[model samples]
Target: MNGQVNARAGASGKAGEKVLIADDEPNIVVSLEFMMKREGFHVLVARDGLGALEAIRREHPRLVLLDATMPGMTGFDVCEAVRSDVDTRDTRIVMLTAKGRETDKARGVGAGADAYVTKPFSTRDLVQTVKEMMARDAAE
Candidate 1:
């Protein structure tokens, strides 16, 4: 899916800020969508890096939860692309991945990810992180 809006939230007529969840895993996408929607965000889903990038440009979500491993492009590559693009340069990106090595983290940061989160992550902590990041973005 390129930028499929969550149907439930779409019909609710009061979806809040946009947050894009870019992951290939169905379970992860569903869970994250639930969590973000509960937090009052208008959730958008993308199944791969390219779709995520397209959605970011097309939809201009407030933040993106990006996955490192996908079919066409890696999250690192997508992050770099977003950072490099003048129009979407300021879009906040949080890299969520199973690659927990120090070098992998460093690479994620080096690629311009605002934050890097490893898998097997705490949902509460992730929500808190997302809130903090969005708050910071708003304050700026």
Candidate 2:
């Protein structure tokens, strides 16, 4: 399985931790998937908003890296839905999108995102943010 993803040998995915990558962009998904796996996370991928919401319901991921826009449900809509649901209210959300305006950030936060990362963001920083957010939540 050349180029296949595998958790670093003997280093299983972090216990009780799963991350859902919800994005419509293929490149973004590919990179985020690899990065999250390397960070000891069991990764789940969703290509659109509906799939994202479905994955959230079924997988109950600890965190969701969500795109701001997609077909079917939009990230904002999904965020609101998750925030409204008691069972998923505590799930951390990081909005990932090209919309970097103050209003956009505000909208993301208003919808209940814990963090909003605009597109063209440094992947290194994104990874660190994810680690920090997830680790902090786990500790709490």
Candidate 3:
């Protein structure tokens, strides 16, 4: 497949699932977009925090790969906003950032993020984790 989208046939595959990747780095966004699209997920991109929040509201993606540091709102703010909104509270969030400190991880979790992945992470691990996450209850 030449970087084009592909939706798998019915039932088990997570084809067409929506995943929003919010990050400011162009390289990161481009790579993440390509990897996620290859996995059959409908991809959405937001370069900053506020745009991320808007995309979350408008797109209602099943999962979000959120960056803690961006131009405006920050991933923590976006996660907090999603967690507070009853309509969007169930949306899954994975805090992806360079900040790998224990406190940073704690804050991400405190803001209701479902998972945390540090920068330079394994794409294979990320994809597999995302699949496992999608299989779990969103509310949990």
Best by TM-score: 1
Best-fitting candidate, measured by lDDT?
1
- How does each model score on lDDT? 0.86, 0.84, 0.82
Residue clash pairs of candidate 1: none
Model 2 TM-score relative to the real fold: 0.90
Q: In terms of TM-score, how similar is model 3 to the real structure? A: 0.86
Error of 2 at 26 (Å): 0.3
**Which regions in candidate 2 have their CA more than 4 angstroms from the true location?**
1-11
- Summarize candidate 1's per-residue lDDT along 1-140 as a digit string, tens digits: 54443333533424336889999999999899888888888788889888888888888888899999986889999999999999999888999999999999999999999999999898889989999998998799
Error of 2 at 32 (Å): 0.6
State the lDDT of candidate 2 residue by residue for 1-140, as single tens digits.
11122223114686567888888888998888888888788887787787887778777889999999987788999999999988888899999999999999999999999999999888889999998997798689
Pairwise TM-score winner, candidates 1 and 3: 1
How far off is model 3, as Cα RMSD?
A: 5.6
Clashes of each: 0, 0, 0
Candidate numbers, best TM-score first, in rank order: 1, 2, 3
Off by over 4 Å in 1: 1-16
When 2 and 3 are scored with lDDT, the better candidate is: 2
Which of 2 and 3 is the better model by TM-score? 2
* Alpha-carbon RMSD, candidate 1: 2.3
